[model samples]
Target: RRKAKRGQPPKPTPPPPVPPIEADEQVFAARLRGALYFFSSAKNRNAFLAHPARYANAPPPTSFLPPTAALLGPEAQALPLARTLSRKLGLVVLSLDEAVKWVLQGASPLAEILRPIVESGTPVSPLHQVQALQLRVSSPDTLRRGWLLLGAPVDGKIAEIMRVCSVLPSRIFGICAQHADASIAGLEAALKEKRLSHRLAKIDSSRNPLAQQHEVERVLLPLLRLRQQAVAATAEGEAHTAEGLEVTDDDFVAKLNPKFGFYCPVTWLNERRLHHCGDGEAAVAKRCAAEYKGVYVCCASDKQLSAMLLRPEEVLAGPPLPSPLPTKETQQAAAYGVSPSLWAELSGHCPVTLARGPKLGDYASRALALKEGKKEFCVEYESKRYVMASAECMEEFLATPWKFSRLTLPSKLLPASDPLDVGELPTRGYSEQTLGDSLKAALTDLLTLERPKYPTLSCTETALKFVALHLKANNPNVRAPHLKHKYSSKLHDYTERCGLLDAIMRTARSNGEVAAHSTASAATDATEERDQGRPGPEGSEPDQTTATAAHSESAACKKASEAPMPDLATLFKAWDEAVAAGLDIH
Candidate 1:
């Protein structure tokens, strides 16, 4: 135990080995992808933001989804795609509650949590946050290829398709009256008779029997190539595991047919295409070659193309997707050239745009000032002043910008020696006092009074000076010129020195203080003084203390020789007679 030898002394056995932690890259990556994909779709993004924790443990089901499907559940179907796509986009896929918690802990940008994973290094992939998604499904093969070949699960394809559906118009059917060799009058007559020419408008407006078919083809070409690539990849992935095992499942070629539904990039719907082969192998490819098994594109009498998709087994095993019987409503939509799927997509995503605005007011003001060479007459409203060319036009106008337009507010006038004449009646209304005329009236009153001293006008010092000037001008005989000259400076000095007004004000303040102290002192002296003046509680005569004080005061007064006392009885009789005559004591 005491082996303390050199360096090799006590190389104690390392503490029990700790198990290595598992890397969560794949799981985290998948979650991130899901978050980005959800945010990319307007519908899903809105739903999440509205109820952050709604998707924490679970979310609500969207349109056409079964009740059994819990929309908010973390394990819900949308998550699979969300995880994968989030990885592609480089976004973080944590629940809204988690995101909020991080933000509360001083996390910045808020989007940082979702951004890194969504933008993970993919060039073509969309960012974590997107304004909208436009879904354009051209073929079934595209969907099949995206799912089977790119290792994308059905959920992932569904998520992408949902996002793409968000930006399309709401109504699938568009209508236009058909005019084949008909005059405008004839068309008007037809309309009056409840008849109109119509045809179904495809969701992809670029594609039809004619016009822009090449553009449609151009966009569709890539999907076709991808389909081929997907097929090859699936076959390779399958063969590596198949070894020499013979596959007996050959229902593929028998199930071949073209069918369409809501398709987005990298996703398609095909019954016999493939399913997970299990045992870690790609699903076997099956052809959709069955006769009369294609999806029915129903065109109503009005030209509406409404789809009634047949069951997967029906399309794959024996029959084609049934053509939907067109009702009056469907017919009307088709007549207008609107596709149901397109309409659905459009309604799913609503887009809005607005025009740009003009420059800021300050910038405009500076520009206006620069345009005029000299400083123009101006007045400030709400701390913002702008110059105008003329004062006569606006000098007396009210500048209420909130109620009136800036153009309506007039410019102010600068003082001049000669009496300034306004050019015309102002477009805006104003108060005479606003024209700096209040001081003139006050001064006029001060000078007309017969009193020797000036009356103090309760107003700003600026107004006082103007008032003083009027007094000096009107009362020339009095030596009040010096007083007028000193008025402004005296007012200023008085406000600064005593920090108060004149004698009247000081007297009023002193009286208020004296009254308050007297009230308090009277309250305190009440018990002692009440006994000396009034009778006791039981109606006894006045106390000895009061009698003694009265005697002392009477003696002192006698020694000084004061007025004679009057008889109480005589005084009472006179008072009674006065009362009888209706004389008031007050």
Candidate 2:
């Protein structure tokens, strides 16, 4: 039955203009047929198509024809059936669309066959609709096969075919070079002769440093694939090979499976700043295009990145030279085209520090607010937060929350003394781990104060006093307690070990000093009753109770000195005090 049609069969896309069936085209076509014949597994058209250009002459073929006749003959002339037949013996014949389908279906053929047809007569692309073209040609024998796809027009029919065939393999998989002005007409003729077929996927031009240098992504997709066979063949020969790059960091390489490359702003920008020269705009634009290839980073603030780019010495020597500021339009473009969250991740990690919040006059500040502040939002996943403005989030937002967050909670809490070792993150949560470690370090510093035992109260109170000293020395807001009752309670915990308190009261009593005005009130209170052995006024009982109080305080201090303190919380009442006191204790 015919499939229901919602629209007219796509208007026939005209074939690209043919190059004068040159010696180059003929050689390229012959080599392509050779590859289709050689590696023609029904399931591996793309793998076959992507065989390297360098391998064009490898492993002598089963059949051979004089290069001139087989390649240069007219389309209507009797063909080189022997060479084509060699492909049939090598593998099974499958339609271009069915090639990928066979791979997906896991169909393996005992033999491979080549079916070359010119689809220039097939009306698939329409002039009005701007459709992407992908070209996949299974011919490792010719370097020009890769060039044809690259040369196909962006707007022309040949370009569309190349765009659709982006998934197809080429002779050179890992590194490629292409010309921007090659005609679509030539590509159409090649297609009409069944030299190329549509692969129907986007080519990633991101990895080829030369793709943008040559302006290929605009006209065509450039890709770098790791051919296992090529890599294995060249592994023993060269440290780095023309066949394929060795996977140096397998873990890192795994992250780029579907995508061919990744952008690391830190290394990329660092390298750029060392070499780049010119005004800030030109330098940044040039460097961004050169290094990051239009990827946006959200981790580093513009000011921080600018400082990294321009350096402090450069900033000071000039009269505050203007830098490349991401325009509101650029930020908007990044938010729309790039992963906003990933951009944030990159920007946040950038080597600059800026004051938090928004500003009115600065363009970058305003741009940041528009694209990443108010426009940005968060979603909860696996009990943690993830930025929504990311490419992964956009693709997997509703599909899988747990997988997106990539959270793996430890089964047990680590001892406060032991540092927790978190592995490299799968997402943008590095700052969270860093902050936690900093907090723990601060707390540990506060706890170490108890080692040099004082004849003071429990070591816990000594820790508190250390904390109090820190608060007084650094932060301005902390002050003496408001309530006398609270102060007495805070000090009571320390009185027993501080033997100086007994001496303090004796001195105060001998001098007839006012109890309220004395410098050592806390000390005096601890030992006054022990020295005097007396009660209070005629009508009231004394503030100091019995000998039992002294005994209890002594025991508590001794016990504290023996055991390791767990946290600043066990010593100080607040977190602010622990950080302030961490230094004092040390």
Candidate 3:
């Protein structure tokens, strides 16, 4: 290279050319179908390269997707599907009916027009319906994570209205029953007319509801993966900035031991005054008396060791070591009956009782229950000891170990006597595992050997009764043949010693069924009247009498049918009372 002239700077050297297929040093990249692909690690890269043909034309990985989605079809099919999705995914469910109710609760003029139609179960006009939906979608909570729209209209005009209102879902699904209905057909036509066929998918409600969930999940897997990526990225970004300040003794004050320090407020510290209290304890006391205010002085060997400032506001006004210390460990131990050592040892474990509750799938509840696990009632499964509340719970575990185990065991390891056989459990179909675990937990709690146990009945007999009642009330379609066979002798005993059996049977008929029956009866009455004779007139005495009787009948039918299924709170209360009384639950 030639030297530059005295006054001029030498020309800079050009950087080397980067390879077209270059990737991060930490990332592995490979060529596939003349295009470069990246993997998180060498193992992933190798796996991809092993089957390049399978991934050559694959869609590019997406990093983020909004959670907005719409479910259109019959209310019977769509509402349940929306609720299931809300539970499985963290999406909020927003139904058109709920929106209309919200609108009616507000001062909007449309509420008056929509009220009669809503009460009569007639669909509101598309324009007014979309307007209500728009209000709900614009809410901060719904906009933050998005919502799963239920019972959305399938008319093209409604879709256009939603689009214009900026509340249209990113994805639209038509929930169809085993036999397609006119509404489902209308949804398909709307999708085609809107040129949104690519965004439309159909979920069949005829199959097991869980199976239907699986189909929806399969379609949403890509979007779910994108959401996961976005969440991870956000967490990583926050990790760098969310570090707490390093605490030090200077940040707090102490009355007795310096180690046990209380936080000092910054405002108090800023407002504090400094004074030299002489060199001795006597002098410091004199100075404190003269000040006529609370003062903190550093002392050593009954002498003033430091001239540090003191703030009356900063000094805690109560006696040291107050009656109840404000510490989480102490509060948690007292509330949950857990020792510190036990908490430390089994902080990660889940108790059999709480784990079997309806909220078994909640992480917070699981963590809390872990501390409540009793050492006396425990069982070893796959070399891990799990704590149970009672012997009945342990037996339930033995009967269905897979249901309680945190680890997902392989089919080969499952017991042969499992009520829900491992082979029969759906894989990637739905959250049946969670449902089964909750059911078993509820049964175990009710059948524990503690007082309130069914009088003169074995644990097996008690469990059979509870299971039969629960299934018949909540899931009438589900058949427990094994339970039926095992408890055949005790099945006929419906003695209402505890009143639970009566309550369950009373709630078996749902309000919807009652309403449908009344509607059918009214239609039959109308047809008979038309065929027999015309009503004398609108305000005739005969017509008025007939209408009054029909109204009374409908009202009575609704009142009788309004008894809902026994919720968790009611069941637990009844269980406790029966156990205390030692009465027959069936």
Most lDDT-accurate candidate: 3
- What number of clashing residue pairs does each candidate have, in the order they appear? 53, 58, 3
Instruction: Report RMSD (Å) for each prediction in the order shown.
Output: 35.2, 29.5, 36.7
Which of candidates 1 and 3 is the stronger one according to TM-score?
Answer: 3
Q: Distance (Å) between predicted and true CA of 511, model 2?
A: 99
The digit string of per-residue lDDT tens for model 2 on 554-581 reads: 5554454444534434333432464567
lDDT of 3 at 561: 59
Give the TM-score of each candidate: 0.14, 0.19, 0.27
* Superposition TM-score, candidate 2 onto the true structure: 0.19
User: Candidate 2, residue 266: CA error in Å?
Assistant: 8.3
Ranking by lDDT: 3, 2, 1
Model 1: worst 10 consecutive residues (lDDT sum):
348-357
The pairs that clash in candidate 3 are: 356-441, 452-579, 452-580
- Least well predicted 10-residue stretch by lDDT in candidate 3: 239-248
Tens-digit lDDT track of model 1 for 1-586 = 4566543577655333222223332211112213422232345544654544436457433222000000121133235533543344232333323323333344345345545543574322332221211111111222222211111111323233332433111111211123332222333343224211120122232233233233323333443444444334334332111111111222222222334221110111232121111111112221111112222111111111111122323322433322331111222333534323233211211111000112344444423332110123333334433332244312221222222122221132122233234544353323342434644566555455432222233345534554555544444355666765675565444333222223334454566556555544544454455656766667776466755665555455444333333443554465467568998533
